[model samples]
Target: MDVSKIHGFNFPCPIRFGAGASKELTDYLKANKLSRPLLVTDGTVAELSFFKEIKNDLQQKGFSVEVFSEMHKNPIKSDVLKGGDAFHETGRDCIIGIGGGVALDVARAIVLRVNHKRDLFDYDDLIGGDKYVTEDVPHFVTIPTTAGTGSEVGRSAIISEDESKKKRILFSPKLMARMVFADPLLTMELPPFITAATGMDALTHNMEAYLAKNFHPMCDGIALEGIALIANSLETATHRPDVESRAKMLLASLMGAVAFQKGLGVVHSLAHPLSSLLDTHHGLANAVNLPYGMQFNYEGFEARFDKMADAFGLSKNNGNRVVDHLFEMNDRLGLPTKLSAIGVEAKHIEELSELAEADFCHPNNPKPVTRADFKNLYEKAL
Candidate 1:
């Protein structure tokens, strides 16, 4: 992949985007005068040759690199504290998050813990907590290895609360990474199933963001374009895994995160509980629930769905056509069409509904979502 022609952009954040952009890490670190860096990643990504190669390159350049890779898929509050201990123990001056959403989120949370004196829950975004995140944290860089979640560029990190078993959003401008290396090459080796699920997650983000009852035209425009990009390249990126397709999906994922600052809807509200309760893959949970969520939201946002259908190139521009297109896309991507297919049962509906109703994302939905509405949506998905 000749990424020499690729360029960097500073759209609210400095991003080095292309196939081989990961190779610029040394230059970025040097330019910022950051040497003692802690690399935060997941255990699986730490085993990859890409991570090993970067570790070796940094070591050869005499940069002391420490790593913390013990975080969970849904990182708990304790994991953030443990990561903070490692960060301080190693005397790391900066943090480089080098994997998917989990690692990036934990990295940001760890940075928060490094400087703040309060407990992690004190800064939860749900309870007017953004003011508590007042300290200037360490310099942070994010390199995403997956094309989902887009936590690399996000200002909030979702960490799980142990006792409640619910995901908590910790939001602050300080959590945003100072730099992001959006290299599609990092996602090339991902399995087709993962690629499909994550691609659908990205699509859901853009679609739901567009449908949310927000007054941001800039975010609306970005969301629509993000959806178009995913519709065009997701299937190819999943099945064939080429550079162009991967690059497009990666870019779309970033756009999804950027646009979703406007808001997300019931899809994320539904998916977060699945992750907290069933330990389901976040992307897969979102993929399974997205169409049902869209269907449930369609009555209030028929014009939005019509626009989305047109974006997907459906001949008929209507809400039903949008739902049909999503079903078709799920089939083509080999994703589960029903919640039952993913081990979700009828018994789980009430609890999932309660959790979904209480979720921060529920209020932003285009259609007002109640506990009863959530139960009905769960039943429909099942």
Candidate 2:
């Protein structure tokens, strides 16, 4: 666990984590005998210096590299389809995801699309479509840029419909990345807003997963630890990032994704609609509405909140304290604590509530979330 030196981990997947882990890409490619790679990333990251360096480094080492960056901030089916096309057209031997959640999701989806020929949404896991995922996928690798969503270690992709903007889960164990190069150096340059938003996103995942209605004790342990890591490091990571803080945030982000196999809850359900309708960043939406969602869940889940309070290092084991601390944390991070500050209005509440009720995450909530409850939460947050 020294952030300055490389450490290898094997849990849900194989991850090479540390300061210079990304430099192993060329050696990995040479050993695996993969000459051509399709690198999937977002538009913003495709232009960054590190991304350019990665691409140039591969080329200089005599490897053929093709890049696919045509994707929305919130990914859709077309994004995966386009990346799949790039993979086939360029005869890519593997798919290497090189940025944040959006980029990693697109890369995982394209890995599925490489061999599965049905309509993209036909593979939606919500509809028992994983049974149709019988074909083998291309070798996949991930190098995460942002410490949010932890999609680098995830086996599922969240893709939305083009016209409806409804999210779909394309999932299978076959979609897991063959390897992950988790370099904290890539995350050091993230601006304050992104660092804060993504850090909150990681915290939300751990909190919601710890409270989700699943019976997984292992996930509960992991979630609480992830929360504690963020509680200690998020502010420093956002305001004055260094090797240790960025590394901890990245580690906590990965732990959040793994812990959330117990599942997410109302906060994600509430946040997804905002990303679909208002084009708000997913992490920012979660950051703003997280406390309200927690407040709604605290009525009968006091014991769970008490555990979370301990994770935050509060002497009192109280649900109310957990809610208040979340609000204060948002303010300290310079993130908006209210939906109104982020352009959410009363007019959008009805539609957002409908979408929230239709969302997949809330079904796993510790308590049931009705459409009426969704409306009420939005109103309270507004």
Candidate 3:
């Protein structure tokens, strides 16, 4: 593929693609001049036999590798600190982030603290609003076990605060992984519901980025293509879980991450708080909030949305059709439609709305959303 033909997209990572490319982990480590590498993953993925294959290979190559599965799902600040302690204790000079978003986030934070002398909160872009003090932390390689989150290419890590229910993002270009290995085989074990939810999350990334009021054509084209791909393949992949469908979903996720570099809007803003507060699955929260944001942004970018609707094969002209299609998609995929259906309540609306409005993604929304607008959306979504 002539990557330049895709307009504004550029990925600096040395990405290896295919079903079994994960077997090349040892070769990649050698190529990158890494010897002792700490493998960071959550308890869930660490328990899988697939991870043991890579672990044993590194051992045979005389590359000291250690496993840390103490990572949390939402990835608390303490988790990163603990991971940092392990990195220091083992004298590991490189990191292999080998799980989902939480593990990836922890790995990113651990690398930063290895050489720098600052509290994790101090480096947070959300709270401290400070630029990350990026030194050469480690040569990091990310291998995503799931086809969601896109933390492999993301330049920020979301860590929960010390005493708060909210999560904060630590940002820097140096936080991006040095290499990413996209192996479709890893996604084969994913359950149908997770596949549906994560695929929808990727779709939301493309949709929100395309709808964002930004001037980046590169992100726009990537988002459009990503959205189209997800619409076409998500259902098939969830039901079938074959190599072809898995490859398409994985590629869609990569494209979604690249697309959202332009910006994301209220869907992410709303979803973040839901994940923090309700402990709902991140992708499911995004799925529930997506339609409301679509309706809200429709008037501001009807033409762009019209183009998207056509691309998604909707016969109608605006976001309403897109919203209807999403509802149907959710139903087919066995996802809950309303917040109430997912155990959220009317009482929680005020607090969630306030926090959501303050979320970083709010300003990038194509339309300005007020507290009332948020409450109304929550009520309607409920």
Candidate 4:
């Protein structure tokens, strides 16, 4: 389909999408007059051929690129501080985030830290902390290697506090990537399990956004379409890894992120603590807990669940049908049906619930969630 030739677009920021779109990165950097950019990625993605190729290409073009792969799976405040130190030490002028949520979040957090005087948590979104983010960040670009989190398109970054193990959302318009290079080919080599988990994360984002009691019709429409695309293409993208399926999943991931600017719900609220405490993969945590979260909210939002059921191609058009479809899909994807299977235990439920109840995403839930509700949902998922 000559995916690279597809037009670049801007919803809020420029997006160059399709296969091999990442190859334009060097030109994009030059056009913006950004010669010294720090490349933030994980150790694993740093070792990939695409990373090496991109670094080599930029180096050959005489760009001063320094790679920082010290990001953790669940990015911590300390990690961002270290990243800030690296950015200053290298004297880099721009930031290029080049992986999934962790790397991207760390990159954005580093940008926030680069010129700010206050602590990282001072910019937490919960306490109207975004106001403190007054300074301009370095020019930023995002190249996503996974079709989840949509951190590339997002304006907020989730970084955990080291002592509390609580996830903090750092948000600002300045945190948005100036450009996103979304190339499906980058995700072609993802293992099937990761494909399945991250695909479900995308689904959760769409569903939660649609269900949230928000007034943004624009986001609602985008969320519904994103759900349908993920429902139709996720299994194939996981199993076969074709260009079309990969591209659809990538688009769906971006749509999910864009839509969730309206807000997320109980699923993310519950998933955050699992990642913070158990160190579970964020997408996998979301996948394991999504159905239980859906069940918790189903009675209150029957019509919303029915719409999602229709998106999943269920003729019944009911909340129960939607939940059933999720279970079936999870089984097919070989995702753990219970949290216990993924190292979450009964003893940890209370602590996890407390953390979930305090999460920023918790208050945005359509059905009000309490500490007891959080505990019950955890028990149900377990």
Ranking by TM-score: 2, 1, 4, 3
lDDT of 4 by residue, 148-193 (tens): 8888998999888887778888999999999999999899999999
Please list the residue runs of candidate 4 whose C-alpha ends up more than 4 Å from where it truly belongs after superposition: 1-4
List pairs with backbone clashes in candidate 4.
none
Clashes of 2: 0
**TM-score to true structure, per model:** 0.97, 0.99, 0.94, 0.97
RMSD to the true structure for each prediction, in A, is 1.4, 0.8, 3.1, 1.3
Cα lDDT, all candidates: 0.89, 0.94, 0.82, 0.90
Per-model tally of clashing residue pairs = 0, 0, 1, 0
Give the number of the best model, judged by TM-score: 2
Point out the higher-scoring one by lDDT: 2 or 4. Answer: 2
Scored by lDDT, model 1 comes in at: 0.89
- Model 2 per-residue lDDT tens digits across residues 1-382: 5888899989899999999999999999999999999999999999999999999999999999999999998999988888899999989999999999999999999999999999999999999999999999999999999988999999999999998899999999999998999999999999999999999999999999999998999999999999999998999999988989999999999999999999999999999999999989999999999999999899988888989998999865665799899999999999999899999999999999999999999999999999999999999999
- Which residue ranges in model 1 land beyond 4 Å of their true spot? 1-4
Clashes of 4: 0
- 1 or 2, greater by lDDT: 2
Task: Please provide, for model 3 over 247-297, each residue's C-alpha lDDT reduced to its tens digit, 9 standing for 90 to 100.
Answer: 777778888888887889988988888877888888999988888788788
Task: State, as a TM-score between 0 and 1, how close model 4 is to the true structure.
Answer: 0.97
